[model samples]
Target: MLEVQSSLDKFKKTTGYWDFMEIGIAAIMIPFFAYQAYRLPSILSKFGAILIAIWLTCVIYTALKLKKAKPHEGDSYIDYLRQCMEYLERHKILSRKLMLWYVFPCLIGVAMIVVGQLDLLDKSWEQIIDTRMVWITLLIFMAIVVFAHQTNKLVVKKEFTPRLKKVGELIRSMEEDQVES
Candidate 1:
């Protein structure tokens, strides 16, 4: 019994530690992406604009999801950690979506870069933007955001959520057993 109790306590502490880390990482991502948007404003190409918009949208969605999450019932450390994992999974899906979104744009960007190197287009940054490379870059960036969001959602829904739910049920059952005893 003592060993079980000690093991449970250790798990709880580990879960709590992980939860804090996940939240911290998510929180940091918002500002980092925002900075990217600000710095890359010149990416007004069609692809660039779309990428920026998508990224901003995902960031907002992530923030909202995090904001709405409530602590799990029973305050079980394991449950709490599971909740955090769910959030992280969602984020991972989003990140994957973002990556997918970037695919086309990146291809276009690469094409443009190659063309520029071959003297097919102006090589200067100003010329690149004028030639529509900005749009291509933007598109790539948006694709990246889409890839991120979708992947995160997938992990959350398929893996983390199910496992977390199972763990939660187990905890609840244990509580019930204790009550009966």
Candidate 2:
């Protein structure tokens, strides 16, 4: 029981840190994106800013939602374990789908910013496509995406999956013990 409590405490601490960090990042990013959209002259820039703002807002919302998964004081061990499992499962799903939720929107937003900047120079579509800026931006985006994806995978594999399994084992053990009682 002490071991289970320790594990739960660790999980809660880790998750609290993660969720708060995400919220912090999103809070900074939302205003930045909103400012860019409000100040930028180009239509594409505005659109890009909007996209980024929306994405970051969703990020904040998700983080806040995860933050609400805390175990109440009166909850039993099984209930607390269940809550932790649900939290882990949600994070696992989010980590697995990082490309969808994290990379793709940012990619589109950055692409728009790059293209819009080029567009402001009175460049034709062909000229814009021919410029090194587009390719470089794309390459940088791809590199970042790959690194983030790999990092998320590693965290899920090393941290989340093991914790989830431990929590599951604890829950089952508790259930069996209860049954025996």
Candidate 3:
């Protein structure tokens, strides 16, 4: 039980740190993305900035959502563990849904920027779009998306999933012990 609590404490701290880092980076980049819209006179640039803004908004929203799962200190042992499990479950759900709420908007925003750049070069679609450059760019970004998704999945599988199971088992056994008493 002490070990489980220690593990949960670590998980909470790590989650809080991650949230802080993500929000901090987003805060810094918000101005940069806003400047991109203002600096680039292209419609695509403005729209791309909007999409990126949406992605950041989603990030903040999700972080806030995760923050709401805080465990109260005064709760009973089994109850506290249950709350910890709830927090981990929330993280698991959010991590699983990153493709919808996290990656897709950013991908579209980046694609818009690439298209805008190609257009600015005054190259026809066939000249630029058909070349190895565009294909390589697409492939690279796709690879990154896959890598990120798989990494998050692995984290949930390795870190959160086992912890969740252990917490659940702890709660169950504690309950059984109580009933036996």
Best by lDDT: 2
CA shift of 49, model 1, Å: 20
What TM-score fits each model?
0.35, 0.89, 0.91
User: What are the runs in model 2 whose C-alpha is more than 4 Å off?
Assistant: 120-126
Clashes of 2: 0
Model 3 TM-score?
0.91
How would the candidate models be sorted by TM-score, starting from the highest? 3, 2, 1
Q: What is the TM-score (0 to 1) of candidate 1?
A: 0.35
lDDT tens readout by residue for model 2, 17-121? 878888998998898999999998889988998999999999888788767766654558688788878878988898898899888998899888877877845
Clashes of 3: 0
Runs off by more than 4 Å, candidate 3 = 120-125, 130-132
The whole-model C-alpha lDDT of candidate 2 against the native structure comes to 0.84
Better of 2 and 3 by TM-score: 3
Ranking 1 against 3 by TM-score, winner: 3
Q: Write the per-residue lDDT of candidate 1 for residues 1-181, one digit (tens) a residue.
A: 3443344355446545755665566466556545554654234333343454454455445555654663454566555545654544554454455445434544454443345334533367666667665566568667766766676677557644554455556557667777999
Assess candidate 3 and give its lDDT: 0.83
- Residue-level lDDT of model 3, residues 104-159, one tens digit each, is 88889988877775564578767886777689878989998989899988998999
